[model samples]
Target: MGFRFRDVLTSWAVPSLADLLLAALVVRPYLLPGGLDELLSDASVGMHIRTGDLIRSAGSLPHTDPFSFALPGKEWFAWEWLTELSLSLLHSWFGLAAIALAAVVLMTATSALVLRNSLRRGESAFLGLLLVMVGFQTSMNHALARPHLITWLFLALSVTIVERERRGPWRGFWLLIPLAALWANLHGGFAILPVYLAVVCTGLGLEAIWNRTSWRGVWRMVACGLAVGAATVVNPYGIGLHQHLIEFVSSPWAIQMIEEYHPPSPSLGEPFYWFAALGALAGLTAVSALRRRGVSDALVCLFFLISACKSARHIPLFVIAVTPIVAGELRWLWDVARRHGGRRSLVAIVHDMDLGLRPQFLRHSSWLPSLFLLALAFRGPLGLPSTFPEKSFPVEMVERNSATLQAGRVFSTDAWGDYLIYSGYPRQRVFIDGLQDYFGPALGNDYLEMLSGGPRTEELFRHWKFDTALVPVKQPLSRWLKARPEWRVVAETPLAVLLVKEH
Candidate 1:
């Protein structure tokens, strides 16, 4: 553990470029204006913390409503209880600093694994950076402090392990069995791994059929898949956890209403555009890569691509699946361009530059520890975020009307409801929050009807008996409230208005 002066100096002065990139990514969020608070933009993270805390205090997982006043005794499935417990423990131990750091590390690891996979597949260092950049493009938009990010990390590692096993001798592919158990507790995104496993096995099996190779690899994957499936049932809920997840994802009511669960559309902005473009590239390259040895790559990429297209939430998963495949094929593209006598072309120039940059990026030293220590030491100066962004959440509105929030049942968007719990939970409960699966379709329909001014809007509203409503200025409900004399605006911010109903 002793650090030699020369070792430290060499590491600092001539650090690994890969390590430097990772360090920069890890440090960026902490150094930003919001510090680690930027990750809390989702606000659902608040309830997760509350749930985790509840689990810790109660000495058991919850099976009934714990944070919602809307449905006081509704059955609940706290499937991600382990992740919540860890988040609560981290918050208690180091505040948001630990939570933020953990998230950033998962994100960084996912991208780094993608880069490493590309290099292993024959792409140069600089070329792999291209996919890494594109992967980050869409992921940052959904980069909240949640458990799903852990799945991205585990899936990346799973791909690395499976691919290595495909190439060489038994190289720890069996480890994925235990990891699957851990992943199931962390996030439902573990569900994607089974899909990935099936895709890989089918693709590799196809390759064997075409090349007349051994079926051992394919059978090995099948065995691994069964083992992984069994491991997922190791949770407290056991087999019922899988049954719950299946029903939740398949229920048209749940997935159709949630924006993230919806298919890609123009309203999603730049991330949608980038995903469309990358998705197109993945399709083209995946189908064509089969001309070489991209059998497994094509199947895996196409499956995730289809999933991401169906639900925008799957885009990061799609990105992880395809980046290495695309990077590897792009090298073949560069070679083709070279054979066509494009030596003086811009492609050639970039290729030349990549060759020159490879040595610099590959420089190995003790940069990981150096950069990690730097991140931890700078936490104080960086100013750990005390609250989420006001623009994204009703921070000021909540602060000014904290008493009203605690004194009455509130109705707001799920995100605002989450912030409410984070700010004043045990004393305050919302009519609804982000846990759509737990609330079920009837409540979801009522919520949408209430907001949209449907025929039963007033009826649902009166039935719910909401005392306070905090809504965005632009929402239809805000305008609806304004037209009614019974609802009065007590406190206002530029982005949100807090309205209380007359008793």
Candidate 2:
């Protein structure tokens, strides 16, 4: 097979404006309503700032969880320091909508940039970017204003930049230093950076030792990995940051207790996202091997693929890490195909297979982008009918309590923790939150028992010394409280029940 520069350009050129804009229409609304935006909405901003308060004040008091109560004198994760600081400052200066708007812009731009770069560098850019989009779709709902999103974008770009540079103008390892630094402060997921760097370095070392490659390239790769690892120490917690991440990961209770942390079970819920992820992984591996391409990088692709399939959060990383490799592989196949049959015959067969889309060079020149933006502006992120089920939260119940609740402390389920924090209860301390490990297994089990209609429900409630409790209407504690004269049901809704303890 022979490669032509024109064919490569056709495959790698930027997607047309029409295509880009249409993608925007598809992506914008999903970015808006509940997922991450809920964290920045009028409901969430106040509590987020309180988290910042704990940090800036250098105080032991926690803004969210009751587990922090026992660990009062100790350090907090501050995993979301950068985001909390940014949102805190933004809330003080302007408002939460500013942060939400910023999130939308950042997420939109990150998506566009990934697509643009993927299209600009490879012979099978369109298909590569499509796979990237599909890969991200599995984890798209969680892409909110949290620190993880910043790390997500940075990690995606870091992989792209390094992969693109493998054969291009190789820069110093210094660029990665800042990525690690910012990533460490942005989210604890920065721990994944060392794993990624190690993987790349290992691949490079294997190439040098076994494949008899240049030692120079191997040393540089190793140096870059080490430099990035050192840069993680630049954050406020210094080396202790890694300890936090290790402890968090080592916590087995979360996987056993937290739903998101649990492994995927197709029989339990939506199969589309998982299936989409699996399809992308299979497509990448088969197509890459078919082209007889970079065997070492194939291993890297496999690592991320297995990780992604095992946990839903890893889908975007797998997509970002492998998209360009797939493109390179497809490029090789295209070249081979052109040799067996002329370019004309090869193109015919490719199109017949519905293998890829043609580059819309004219898309960059159209007014279609304007229309797409207008549609986004009109439709907003909620997308009308709402993506998830409405009964997911007890909005009316929360609203009713919003007026009556003077109680400063409350107890609620871990799943509803983020929602309560976002519901403008900045001063309220939840019995639980997303930081699962901090609560310890015993308390977490007690929380479950309290909600499970167990006999120990009342005993656990008194043990926690909760001023009031907000639980599902279906909870045993709710029923017990409703029957007791000492506890009064202050508000009731199909989604949740609020009970106030009689003084």
Candidate 3:
């Protein structure tokens, strides 16, 4: 197993296109303008980190609304506490940059695993590279620094293991068992793992019935499925986590109110374009898979396609799970076209280009690992902001009005409410924040009514005793507050306005 000169030359001197792409994927996000800031733009990261700190100090996970005066002592599920703890540790040690780096690492790991799985499935590197961009696009769309980033990595890893098991022995498939446990602790998305394994097993059983797959494979899938399912319950909440996720995902109210729960629109551009394109290609692939009794793919594709169609958040799940299938389909289509069509056509050119890429395709080098390490070392020191961007959040405004924000019963946007918690948690509380599930429709609707300057605005404000209000300066809510004789604008930034009620 000693390395020859040729091996050394190829492995050390020249990296593959995949290797370089992996490097670019990791560094580009942090290097781009406001990229690190953009990752922290979501206020949920603040919730998770603060919750982590609370858990760490108290030596237990929180079960009540710890950051909100609106719903104090409500039965709250801090289901993602493991991820929160991790984020807390990173932020505690390295500031916000570490969380950004962690996110980049998660996204990069997902992408790298997808690429490896694609190449392993005999996908042509040229086409694989192009189609895998769909996964990258999905990552960029939801690139916020949160626990779900961990889910992205786990999803890609779990799917790849399942696919490999279908083709070969259940060698590394056992990893999913412990992975399920860990994923269960990290994010609510762990529910998807058991569902995915069940889908794959069902598909394998269908293939077995058609004699396209061995019964051994089907039984192995069943064993793996049961193992993973059993392992998932080995979390802090046990089966309760599953129950909570079921209720959350099934809640029609959540579907109507939460933006991510809504179906993706094509008009949103490239993210949806890739999703729509891959979805169409997946349909064709699934149909073709049926002839060979490879119903595993058909089921997998069909299930995820519907999931993607129903929720924009599930778009990444589809992209990670189905893009390889789409890449294989593209390859099959390319091969057919090249064989039957004119020699000088686009098909012939792509075929030739793919052939040219083959030698470098398999080459491995230190570039990707080296670049990732470098990115990690430089990330914090490199232009990472100490807090959420001022342009995005009312960072300076919060500092300037700290007295009013911390001491008074404050009302603000859900996002800014989250920031308020981050800034003055264990002391100050918000009228509401982005934890819409915790708040429920009753309170969320009331908050929305307040924002709308609706009939409930006065009654709710009086009931809640909200003496301090912070909102985006340009919103009608701000103007509405300013119009009230009992309220006066104390300060205003281009991004946010602070209003205090006249006593």
Assess every candidate by TM-score: 0.90, 0.79, 0.92
Best by TM-score: 3
Model 1 error, position 13 (Å): 10
Among the numbered candidates, top lDDT falls to: 1
Please state the error at residue 181 of candidate 3 in Å. 0.4
287: Cα error in model 3, Å: 1.6
Question: Residue by residue across 141-203, what tens digits does model 1's lDDT show?
Answer: 677688888888998998888768878658598999999999999888888888889999899
- Candidate number with the higher lDDT (2 or 3): 3
Q: Write the per-residue lDDT of candidate 2 for residues 20-85, one digit (tens) a residue.
A: 654564455556545433534222334455576555666443433423342354445655677677
Ranking by TM-score: 3, 1, 2
Better of 1 and 2 by TM-score: 1
Give per-residue lDDT, candidate 2, residue 333.
Answer: 64
Q: Which tens-of-lDDT digit does each residue in 302-350 have in candidate 3?
A: 9999988888888888878887776766677778888898889887887
Candidate 1 ranges with C-alpha deviation above 4 Å: 1-14, 25-37, 338-377, 453-455
Better of 1 and 3 by lDDT: 1
Model 2 segments more than 4 A misplaced: 1-49, 53-74, 92-96, 267-293, 346-392, 403-408, 422-426
In model 2, residue pairs whose N, Cα or C atoms come closer than 3 Å (at least 3 residues apart or on different chains), thus clashing, are 16-363, 17-363, 17-364, 36-144, 43-422
Segments in model 3 whose C-alpha atoms lie over 4 Å from true places: 1-15, 25-33, 338-366
